[model samples]
Target chain A: MNNELLAVRSVSKAFGGVQANQEISLTIPSGKIIGLIGPNGSGKTTLFNSIVGYHPVDQGSVRFQGKEITKMLVPQIARLGLLRTFQQTRIFSGLSCIGNMQISAPVVRSGLKSLFTKFPIDDMEDIEDILAFVGLHSKRHLLAGQLSFGQQKLLEFAMALIAEPKLLLLDEPTAGINPTLINGLIDRLRVANQELGITLFIIEHNMRVIMNIADHIYCLAHGQLLAEGPPDKIQNNQTVIDAYLGAN
Target chain B: MRAWHYLIILLLAVSAPFILPDYRTQLAFLWLMVILALSWDIMGGQMGYNSFGNIIFFGIGMYVCAVFQRDSGLEYFQGLLLGMGLGGLAAVIIALIIGNALLGMRGHYFAIGTLGLSVVAGELAGGWDYIGAGSGLTPPLYPGEISERNVFFYFLFFVWAGITFVSLWWVYRGRFGLAINAIRDNEDKAEAMGIYTTRYKVSAWTLSALFLGVIGGGVGNLIGFIDPKDVAFSGATFGVWMILMAILGGKGSLWGPVIGAIIFHVTQELFWTLFLGWQRVALGLLIVLIVVFFPEGILGWLRQRYPHRMRDANNSTEKNKLNK
Candidate 1:
């Protein structure tokens, strides 16, 4: 089996005079933990954005589940079970943590009729379960804004969980979190992958976390793909070291 | 706050004309203000659209209804009923047509775009001689005593406003409310979360237009004349008042606009009586006070002050749910 869930072919995007991603190509196989690493402004985030339909690409195409999706809008792509999380974490701060989850319920996006219907009561159990999984159950009723930064990130993850996406693109999931929380987050990400059978494509700056968590890794420098291999090979790749990891 | 509380308020509202016959007109005006604020809140507060041209629907409604009564030659009551329904339908069509274009703009762009739309609507109505142009249109007279006319229109507004409130309450309790609130909090994220943001935004605007248009017909009849700018499309008065009232009470909460409308209408009426020619200045000062001290509005301020009281009520309900 090809096992490819997402395929990006020579995708190029430029913002005015700046080339954010140039002829970038990659694949996310089904049920795999894929990691993207790059120096600042190296177009790691841009690639994620392009794949998730945040912006139209200047060149190239993105295919999800063997279907062309380069021209699809964000909501349409998301409805196809491709969802993403932001680097800064975008929870509905005005709503309670539970409310955020409730709003993110799959039914909300299911169809026109679902909009007028009350949120299904049975979803509450699932929400509470995921909240507890993220250790946010106790604070479910509190405004999401009141949560700590790490908690907010967890809430965002919980929201994505509620959507029941097939492939989730996480942008810098652990940048602002402390080490302990990072460890916890990594564990949940693992559980979400292995237990839930969801595929993950993550952008990470944390060397240790990405190395340990991702089965395969892609490294970018200056909007160009620098290296791609299993984690240990990417770790040993001289080009990646020279461009991003620095000489030690 | 409770079933009984709503019941008491409804009882008072239903009995207001009889109890205060002298202030019947003023009471009717209160309901008008309520409808305006509530409708505006759906887009401005909930969906974060902040459209300034909602008055376009009201204007269209007034004109369509009056024109129908004039040209259709139907009896007064039949014409009025049919006219109001046609008015609402016309407003909805206009909303759908314009919303697709205007709703594409975000933030200040959307607001300015809608404002321009409002101005353009007024100008169009002013130039169109079919519905009286700058001269204004007059609907057929009410077929009853003046007192009966007041009571009839009063009930018309009361029932309409009640329907508005109840409908909003229903909408806000469901997934639609959550979806719009998500859009308000963050549009990009909302889209990425699979919310067709444009669809929701247009739908929200359409809901406001639907209500505003229907009410506009009744208001045109109540006022007896519809000047293009001053009456039918009074952007300066009705449009601005709706936004201000929503802000004054609270934007996001269900009761905020209602509370804000009641307080603002009563206060504005008082200012008209007390300040006379200076009422505009008094109103301006009131707006400043609301923004300065209660930027979050009265409900937000109350929530900030007694967070636990609200949370406790929530907790009790949640605990009962858990027990069940």
Candidate 2:
């Protein structure tokens, strides 16, 4: 219990008759990579959505950095240094990739002065370095819509990095990317955790990626927590394997 | 694209009344259209709110200014300034109140809610007797019928149009512009990235109200008389025209609405003069055509044809040239 960065205590959510998540509890320690995996309808996405305040939970609490955040909106959570990315990659299609990078930085103070001034030079430099790190420096000038789907995911990831979230909740970062790019992306995620010190709570579908990357893994099934342990233990856990087998 | 290109346009705009004195009134109206379209774009185009009720601000501005002039025993110019100032202030206050309520409704709900606001406002203004009811009220009569009044109003409108364009242009290049564009693209994502969207939307609408209210006061005095349905709350005319001009010019670009206003005004004038009674039909047809055929507008087409124009200059020019 080395100072949990995020604490989800007995959280539950329901959509009419559908119980999307029930009595789900988890803790993510600071400076660690955590994985959440479940079959398509097992409430994995719902859990991620709840933590980021895309919507309210029917019951329970979410505390980030020991501060209560259950009542917060998405932007408020982001301002508090918690951020999440969409599975579909919600980059602004009409803006150039650099524009995407530029807009992603949290505004310190948006005032009448914001109307008259250019974005700070420091932000520009930061965006360039982030873009380069994400392997998008050459394509930064291209409109985000023009980028390939894989590249757009990278762009979205880079944007989240620029926001400088203390804890990041990524929804399926390798959903549709080619296998060849998977290793590179996983390498980048580690670098983000190790170098940037971002606590990553990733919802991953790819077995190889999650098993190799996550320090601790949580298995969700039928809207409840099935198992939680080290990645190797989760990988070897008979119950976790049987749940995936039954779902398949 | 270049400073000189804009400078030349500015010079031409300033000299338009002198160059064509006969069309001074029409030019003044055109400048007003530029203001309306550009200000409307602050919400409709930039933030993707598509506020059909924006004309309410214009109408409020007109009534407030006219009421001030009629009731207050101040000098003409002094009264005009005070009336306009108060009018803008009133519009901003109303916007803040209604904006918080109205902004919660997304997409078509927001659009329809705003549309109802303008309609209800017109009806309310029509029934109220203190503001002269349906028959309308005239501005304080000018002494001795000043000869250069058209030129005076023309230059005034030009100056206002210049202010609207320059002010918005500054915003469109900065952080606020990016915030609105992000809202337009995907509001949820913008908020998730840490932009407080409701505050931004309300603020943008308030800014639009301030400008519209001032323009309303100016236009009210320029016209000298106002009818609740026909002039002040002419939602069908002014409201529709604001959205149409922004769309025709290219919705999200800085210079798009201005160019659209010029083209739309010139063509609309020609249609009004040529077709007379059939101008409304022509307007309907032109809107249909623009919506169907040129939905992207001239700027969008230009952006597509010349991609380099839309990219930030931070990208090396050498790379740009190579891509070209």
> Best candidate per lDDT, number?
1
Interface RMSD of each: 0.8, 1.8
User: lDDT score, residue B295, model 2?
Assistant: 84
List of chain B TM-scores, one per candidate: 0.96, 0.93
Model 1's interface RMSD: 0.8
Candidate maximizing DockQ = 1
lDDT digits (tens) for residues B1-324 of candidate 1: 677988999899889899999888889989999999999999999888888989989999999999999999899999998999999999999999998988899999999888877788889999988889899999999999988888898899999999999998888767788789888888988998999989888889899999999999999999999999998889999989999999998897778899899999999999999999999999999999999999988877887889878654332433344444
**Per-model TM values vs. the true structure:** 0.97, 0.95
Residues B1-324, candidate 2, lDDT per residue (tens digit)?
A: 567987998899888888998898889999999999999999988888899999999999999999999899899888887998888999999999999999988888999889888889899999999999989989886554444777888888888889888888777777777788788888888888988888888989999999999888878988989899889989889988999999998987777888799999999999999999999899889999998988888777676777776644222322343343
lDDT at residue B16 of model 1 (Cα atoms): 89
Model 1's alpha-carbon lDDT is: 0.90
lDDT of 2 at B113: 89
Candidate 2's TM-score reads 0.95
Task: Please give the range of 10 consecutive residues that has the lowest summed lDDT in model 1 chain A.
Answer: A111-120
- The pairs that clash in candidate 2 are none
TM-score of chain A of 2: 0.96
- In every candidate, what fraction of the native interface contacts is reproduced? 0.78, 0.67
